[model samples]
Target: MNSITHYLHNELPRINAFLEAQTARLDPVVRPAAEHVLGAGGKRLRPLLALVAARALGCTADPYPMACSLELLHSATLLHDDILDAAVMRRGRAATHVEFGRTGTILAGDVLLALANRLVADYDIPRLNAVLSEAILRTVTGEVMEIANVRNTAMSEERYYEIITGKTAYLFQGACECGAILAGCGAATERAAHDYGLNLGIAFQLVDDALDYVSPSEITGKPSGGDLREGKMTLPLILYLRTLPPDARQKLETRIAQDDLDAEAARAIADRVAASGCAEATRDAARGYATLAAQALEAFPASPERDLMADMLDLVLSRNK
Candidate 1:
């Protein structure tokens, strides 16, 4: 685990440098907004998966530029999502939309999307282009579905899975699949890469949802229970609701419908979720996905990159933020 951590610590900066260069290409007026968001660092999990996948397949390609492009797309999504969620903080800093006005932030996001497309266009691989485009399309569809379902406390577990899988998991799947494709791996190996990333991504998001209830704002990069405050029904809350008796469930639903979603209300709801044992339930589901993610590596030979991915699965399941 320490070795894998060291490798990631060394490699992430290269990706960061690549991102810095890519964002530099934007107009000076738009550059600050893009740079601000880019500079606010994240786990960079999607791009890391790409690099690891390429390495696991023994590909000689640099993989950095392609990996960086995926990060650009992800940052763009975060910019848009903050606006949609009316969020103020991101990565412990003001959200791009909060720092830059809505119009400017929107343009910044568009610039990122355009730059991402431009980067892949330079690769001139039709299949790579298709994978990126499909990922974006699926992510957008999932966002729209989530927006349409806002405040729907009755949102089913099945629907929640569909939303998170499409919005989050598919992008990770595309990144790993594209990485394997760049490595010129066999079809079976490419399928394994996709599966590994897909399951990892699901586990990642599940942990993120769990963190929202248990982690502090300093760690989570946003306020605790922000999902519930935004009326987004995540798995913990959904499962917690199921545990309630009919009248208790109705009262909780009524409480959720109350206006303002003040701090007191958020904490109250979070307390209920904690006492109901739903956080543990959500973690168990995340463990299931992590197991699937680990299994996906069975087809690949033993390598530092593969071992790094195995360690990452543990990190995802155990992460508090």
Candidate 2:
């Protein structure tokens, strides 16, 4: 196996064990649902990023507790986001809100958020606290803005970038920055790590949006064209809107505005998008961001850790689900 793959092979089980152990300490009211959600597997990518970042920066101290906070925070967001999206499946299983009532799911998310905070606080690092706080604020703001802008055909690319950066990039920045801080790295190194993570996050989300049009429920663990039905215009769809003739584009916008979407309508549009090369265009955009993500590591010296980050950029751009 390559460096990154080999590393994950060894560390994934240990990381999962750590997370499963923490589930027992959650608030009693939300514990069962929270455990169920947590048990459903994910790549745990955010925490994995933090851990690799710490090692890349030559961290001597144990960074697992601090790094794992990102996973907890990310899971909490999944619980809350599923409610807002009315999503049925997450990580190939029922969403927390489906298994537990909405209130219970929301409370479980809150408990996870509190637990994440406590994990960071135990390290006694002011920068870590501030990073986590800012990530939370920005992520919530982005989600609120997304809700406000649903089915907006006229939404500008700049505005879309801003929302996605807030929602996705900030949390990634926090994770990498926390890793750097825990490693006792200097300011310049921390900034490099921050920039790498921001670009990586943008690339990750771009690919995810592209796959929504093309990937099926079996492969992706979520319904294909879920965003189309929800009337969310991601980068792929937005890029497609720019190519259509005026009348055709207007008709599509009108259809997207329909109060009740049927399966046929959603499927037709998704198929059109897939055939139109919009998904490939979106992947191209992700490649640009991935290039920036890799470039951010140019200043760091060569090491197995550094090499793995380069491999990670490729992995992020290539991910289908």
After aligning candidate 2 to the native by TM-score, how far in Å is the CA of 176 from where it should be? Answer: 1.0
What is candidate 1's lDDT per residue for 61-121, written digit by digit as tens? 7788788889999999988999998999999989988888998998999999999888887
Query: What total of clashing residue pairs does each candidate reach?
Result: 0, 0
Each candidate's lDDT (Cα)? 0.87, 0.86
Candidate 1 TM-score versus the reference: 0.97
lDDT of 2 by residue, 64-112 (tens): 8877889888889889999999998998899989989899999999998
lDDT of 1 at 286: 93
**What TM-score goes with each of the models?**
0.97, 0.97
